[model samples]
Target: MANNRNTSFLSDPALLEKVDKLRDLNIGQHVPLPQLVVVGDQSSGKSSLLESLTGIPFPKDQSLCTRYATQITSRRGDVDRVDIRIIAGPHASEEHRQHVEAFRMPTPSGLKFRQDFANILQKANEKMGLRADVSMANGTVFSEDVLKIEVQGPDEDYLTIIDVPGIFRTTTEGTTKDDMVMVRDLVTGYIKDERTIILAVLPSNVDVATQEILELAEDYDKDGRRTLGILTKPDLVLEHGAQAAVCDLIQGKKRPLTLGYFLVRNRGPNLESEDQSELDQIFRTQPWISLPQDRMGIPALKEQLGSLLFEITQREYPKLLQDVSSQISKCRRDLDSLGPSRQDEREQRSFLTHIAGVFQDRARAALMADYNSDSVFDQVQLRLITHVVNITDLFSAEFQQSAHLRHFQNPELHEPAEETVSSGEDFQGSNSLGLTISNLQDLLQATGVNDITQEELAELGEIIDLSHETTLPSDDVTSWIRDTYLNTRGMDLGTFNANVIATTFSEQSRKWGDMTKVYMSRVIVTIHRFIATTLRSVFPEEQSRRHLWSSILDGLLQRYKMAMDQASLLIEVERHKNPYTLNRQFADALSKARGHRITELLRPKARKDTRQYGELQNMVNLDDIAKAAEGKSNMEQQQEEIHDIVRAYYQLALDRFIDNIFQLAVDYSLLHGPDSPLKVFTQEWVINLEPEQLERIVGESKVAKKRRLKLAKKIQDLSSALKILKI
Candidate 1:
């Protein structure tokens, strides 16, 4: 066996072998890999440096000066073997990718690497769609496809190295402007990876400051921390009169680097020992002898590069582990989102049934205000009960503000209107109304009636403010009512006709239909949004969700229409039906309104008689009050009574309208009713679905299938990578 000491000289063979396995797992394509990459201008001895480090001869033709990136990984094993493959680019066509994957080179006996490797590379080039015989104008000169070479033997040292396309400033006959930009971009991209240790190869004959690779290295690694400068072609140093600057670079007196520089000369196909002797002899005679001995030869350069790569890998191990774990988690989530394959009726039905179960559970929970059902329900938008309640409250308030056709004011009772304070101005003309709602208690003091509760007074106040802007003046209302009563009067004689009361109430409440229609439409829209959001979460697949939505849409629309029709019917009953209420609150409201009006009329007389009677109520006795009320014409008093009846009926109907619209129409028809939207997709419903219908609702699309397959492969590769990392 080869000496174990040789393997230990570079890095732990065990660790490098694990890294080799990681590379073979192909995880680097997704994340940055810990490796060394050699970059330089064209014809700058990049291949030569790679050959010296790995003891493998690469093709010397300038035409192959990195038509594609090359990844060389060396490992120790029982049998000497060399295997080559191509990793297709992310955007490579499926047909071309298949060809690239199937490409193989037959290893000759004894592994004559130098003699046959050139033919292997040519075959790979052609496989990548690049042909030497084709001109640049006719064929692609470069490929993003990576050519990977694995060499394993008992004598091999463990290492991984990559050679990217050389950076060039100008394009030649075989290259175009696009090719120049492509090569530059490729090289910069490789060095930009923080985990990669840059091997910046520069010819000794070139001006070190003018080298593009050094500029690029500085651009990515400004402190020169991960960069190692390698000076090649030292034989041409004296002939090109570049010795002074080259010696300055070697001595680290100019353009200093943290890892510093290495001076190496190509071995030119000679034996390793002979090449070492010749390189040592060349450096021993001149100013090069003063250069550090540790930085002068290929053997020393290899040790530095191996140790640096080891240090970087050790430093970046945690990050690599985190990256792989994160990728695994992401791939798993993607796979879960795609759900299982649904190629047949059984699978489709199974998947959809599961979805329906979850959907029904969540929807039921939201409707019942049981938000603890799932984490998704924690969001306010998903709290269906709260959303509905809030909308209902807003509707109630707006209807109160905008429902009335005209507000009543007593034109007969003359009194000073006190200034009224209001919180909001949404109700118009309320401030200027003759009666100030806040002072109602003061006026009622003389009536000796305190039966009206604070809640009742507040309700009355709100109605008064909202009705301040009247569509008809008080006299006009009284005139209309008197005329209506006279025309519709029957043989009832002294009593006003019932038809007059109903017609007056109906005319005042005409705004109910339009307002209720808008409210129902809003409720329908809200229900639709909630259902759509729920289905999206359940189905995940766009096509499946769409089909399911279309299937259920007809039922939802029908239910919504029913709810709207119900609301319209309620409005019609309020607007045209007979005005009647058995609730005692209506009588109480009527009495309170009458007392307020009577007090206003009696205030002027009461103040004048205060000197004679000592108190207002004591001065105005019942018979005296009756004789004063007899002063007005009978028709005017009846008209006043008509106005009060309509006002009381309006307040009563407003409450009923609000309740009927929300509970009977919205809640019953759209939310929790028998045919409500919440009940559209049930376990029984899904069970009753035909096989073809189930497939249509839950079938996996081709795009989804393709994505699922892709994610599965990614997860497999990442899992293998994790296992190797753990090892």
Candidate 2:
């Protein structure tokens, strides 16, 4: 039946591709026979079963027998013939090969070739009664070297047997560092293959050791396929009624038992003979399997195993095939998308332009809301100076009252005036000195200073003296005063104020202005720095956002690739000479062809020359507006350019956002087989822009006409991009 199916399937190219996909996904492998892994307690008749099945004696003793995992394989032509090989380890190297020779005694020494050398070491450890710790440290543990052996039966069927360590017995010594390392490596290595089935052997009688083995197995079996329980030492249970009671207890407790118990005697020569009557009588006349005597039972067990193997193969293959095909298809799609096609370039440009516009719009709104007022530039400067003077006065007064400065007098308030007795050079310098004093007074008044009365000035002098006279340090007072002043007044300052002031005036001509600019700059810069630095420190949200976006993009891309690949494969398969190989080839072909046509239609196209020329003309008109705005006063130019940049960015970003929304809506419709919430939203969407808002953004305040024109051109370009993207 399998041969007929293969012949038919392979004849069709499309069917062949599907089969290839399955193969790539490791899904469809022709497994004719099932492999059995036998594991148990050290003296639980495990070796006896191995001997019974393979007709080969396995060494049995109490001192840690089966030190290494053994594999038994049947000879290719002879179903009844078997071969054994040991998995190699670090110590199985040539240098240590001789040390293992003693264990393979009685077996042919010719088998001690390089290929068999590792097995010799394992066998030696088993026979020599090496402690698990020593063997493990020396790296001679059997679990570390899982064995594989194939057994060919007379019926042309083969059984591959894996003999692993009786974990129940091995772990009895208590977990050591070496044991843990070895166990970890063993479990990892054993379970690495999803197809590998685990068979756990347990005594028929219930015990704490058996429970522990089951628990350990459960912990390590990720797919839950490999761990199976095999009840051994059934003969012991038959001989003693207590054993039957133990089995009853275990069964009552609901212990997981996959395979039924095998009744076998390990210590006697009549092991091959069936004693069914005696075994039945011992177990109160219940049906039970008697090993060696129950030869017919072995074939039954093999048949059961064959069924399981077939089921697993069928379950895993198709899925694997589907996954591999999907991955390949996705890669092809991505390559196509990334190519320098005019459509792709147009799409990318459109997307970028949309994004830029959205940013510009948001920035424009923020700036307008923050900076829109009548004569705001001049008002901001005047307000800043007034705030600084008030803060300084308050701080000075606080410092004078502070305990640390109690001993010092204020020089400005207490110093005696110099007598004006002019010498020949002094007479000429008086005019310049008088002018300087008058100018300083005018500047102080402009900063909102009121005339200080002589009596109030004397009171201020007394307070300063009191502050200096105190025992506390002056540094504390200075710090406190500075903090109080900055905190109360500097908190309201904007980041651009100082830069604006500096740009407005020269350093030499306006000493007070420069001082004000420097101080305000420090304040604004410090506040902005604090906000930025604190956000980064407190919330790694930016990094998290990036990671989230990347993951989302990856998942979306993967799904897209899969769909494309499946579509492509579907198309390829329909073109086959023998379409009937797959039952649904015609339907798949039509669906895929329709999808491809739609995708082609959706592909973007670059703008035409006429459209480009129209956009350029719009841009030129906007540029003229900007140039006219730019020739105005410095303050006007700044405002106009700032407004233009902000608006342009906002428009660009908005366009991109709209485009994305539309794309998402389309994808949603495809996924759900109809329009979804996203589709509905896209359909109802409108880009709302208020004229009032735009006017607020480009304030009515006077700005250079040239700057306005420049800004207008940028806005036009941004709008053109948005139109192109249809956002």
Candidate 3:
């Protein structure tokens, strides 16, 4: 490594050009670029100082000219020539762009410093719509773009400067609120760069308290370490007792900066602009500046800046490489996350297909209830299962006790049944309640009594109350109880028809539609979820893809909603179909209930029948015992059949409806529908996309693409620069 202490080594042209190239690529806005940044309020001799440094009479008009950031860079070269260029900004107007483009193209005529450049700047204002007589009420001025001027002459100091727009207290005739803000932001953009050293220029003639640059500098660099205060227009400090204050300011007695201050005299407007030697002689004549010759002249400031920048560069050059590498890695990672650039048809095809396959795998997993998988739709599957289970369990419990199965529950209807007196003397009177099931086989052979009357069943529900006459034996007591229930067995007269069954389950089965809504919501949610996650991951620029996905999903979501509505409609249609309990296990349930009740009632401890061999067993009279047994048997059988019918009907109907409807929902719609997100792509759809449409889908915004390209180039350039650095 060369000794950085040597002035020649510190001022190496190659070393300084690395940062300049980054500036050209415009990487400074993102990653900090090491340079001297000049900032001051309007009329603070900012432009004069830059002109003195670069030896160019840059336009001094604040409103019409020099309103953009100007980068003046000088490198050591024998041919004293100037290279000028404009880096157009994202918001640059037509006028500014035209001028920039014209400047970029080669002219048949050789580059003329005076006329051609002046024409460009003037025409630029015209393009920006700045009036010859500018005013603020209807102001339209744009373009915060940079104008770069490079001067390379023999033994030129390797100094790079960022001269930004001047700050103003108030907008004048031509300037608006935006103009005021634009200038400040433009200046702040440069100074806020951590790697750039702030050259805070303030007129010595004005009070330093009013300077806006230092206030802004303090915001970004609070310690005032990177800030160097330059007191321009020192000649204007000839007022009453201002020279003493200026001298104190220069000597660091007031408003102290870490690098202190420099008092440089820009040539007064009336005087011919003096050369470097002439300025030195002029500065020596000044009372305030002559005392501190080392810190009062333009030459001294150049030396200080060169040393300062060199030291900063030497310290930060390695970090610059690291910063570039870090940004590059970030951009690449983001690009990778966007998957890949779907620029061509083939890439687009592959990108869309990959996303589709991923969505399909996830959707299939969800459908199969594979919650154990780490697929995106695992939670959806779990939630869906929970919903189905909960709804089915509730619906099953409800269906069992439905009103339509009431007669089935209580076997013999006991209300006003058809009454008839048989020709045979065995039949009851015409006015008797429902037909008696006094003899089961006879009722089955009927006096036309297929169903026992509700009246008869109610009448028979009564049990004869018996007192245990004179403390009879337990056998006698049990026998009496058995005989009582036997005499009052239930009778039913109402016919079990489709209307009765419909009334029973209509309310319960009506809720099948509600279940549709609930399950449909889950289905819709999962579908939407798949689309959202898939589309969101397709591109790094969420904003770019949002419009396209939103358009696609708008119609899709509407269709899905309609499909779900139709599902509800189909369920409603299913509800309107006459309810019927078909081929239910009525006989089996009746037999099971009868046996269960009879066994429960006639258990050994509770029975009153005489024992065959045990003498210790309690015995009732044989005739009474027979009557007791017959009575209990009849009562038990009648109740059993009713319980059996209700149980069978409930179980069958409940199972069928839930299984049929829920299975239909699971199979038919969302798992497959609004065409399923997986099948939403085609070769031509992704491939032959219009540019405008592609912009909505995956194409990068022009500004963002430009920024990425700039960063990528900067990385390449910085990597090349890193090769030149020995350390």
What's model 1's lDDT at 441?
26
Please provide TM-scores, in order, for all candidate models, with all chains considered together.
0.75, 0.34, 0.65
The list of candidate 2 runs beyond 4 A from truth reads 1-36, 62-64, 68-71, 75-146, 150-156, 168-177, 184-196, 205-211, 218-228, 238-240, 243-297, 320-727
Residue lDDT tens for model 2, 1-727: 4344333422432322232222222121221112345655556567766654444456554344665556554322422433334333433433333343322233332223323534544554554334444424444344443343434444433344556655543454434556545654554445335555555555665563545555655666643455555555555554456555544433533444443333333333454464433423433334342222221234334444444444444455454444434543554454333222212334333332343353333223322333343232243222332333333332222222221221111112223221211111222222233433234435445543233346434422221111112122232322332233334333333322333222221111112222222222222222222222222322233532233233233333333333333333432332221212222443453354344333332322212244654653222233343344333554433332222222222223223322332233222221322332111111112123233422232222233233344334334433332232232
Residue ranges of candidate 3 with Cα displaced over 4 Å: 1-11, 59-65, 93-99, 104-143, 170-178, 210-220, 236-240, 282-290, 329-355, 375-383, 386-390, 397-587, 592-727
Per-residue lDDT of candidate 3, residues 1-727 (tens digit): 1234446645465667777876776667557878898888878888778867766665566545566677888777767677767776645555665666455422222235533655656655554444533454443554566777776767677788888777888877767798788777777777877788999998988888888888999999998889999988766667658888888887788878898898787765565556756755656664754467778688878888887778787778888878877776776665455455555545555665565465555545555667566544333323333333433333333332221212232222233122211111122322133333233224223222223345423322231111111111122322332343344333434322334333334433444554445445434444454455555543435665675565465455555555565666666655665644545465565566555544443443343544667544534344543344454444354333333443455455555655555555543544454454334543445555565565566555676565556555555755554444433
lDDT of each: 0.74, 0.36, 0.58
List RMSD in Å for every model shown.
9.4, 32.6, 15.2
For candidate 3, give the lDDT of residue 300. Answer: 79
Candidate number achieving the greatest TM-score relative to the actual structure: 1
Q: What is residue 174's positional error in candidate 2, in angstroms? A: 12
**lDDT by residue (tens digit), candidate 1, 275-383:** 5557657778577887778888887787777777777787788898899999999999889878887888888877878888999888889889898778887555567
What is residue 650's positional error in candidate 1, in angstroms? 6.9
What shift in Å separates residue 26 of candidate 2 from its native position after superposition? Answer: 14
Superior by lDDT: candidate 1 or candidate 3: 1
Residue 94 C-alpha lDDT in model 3: 50
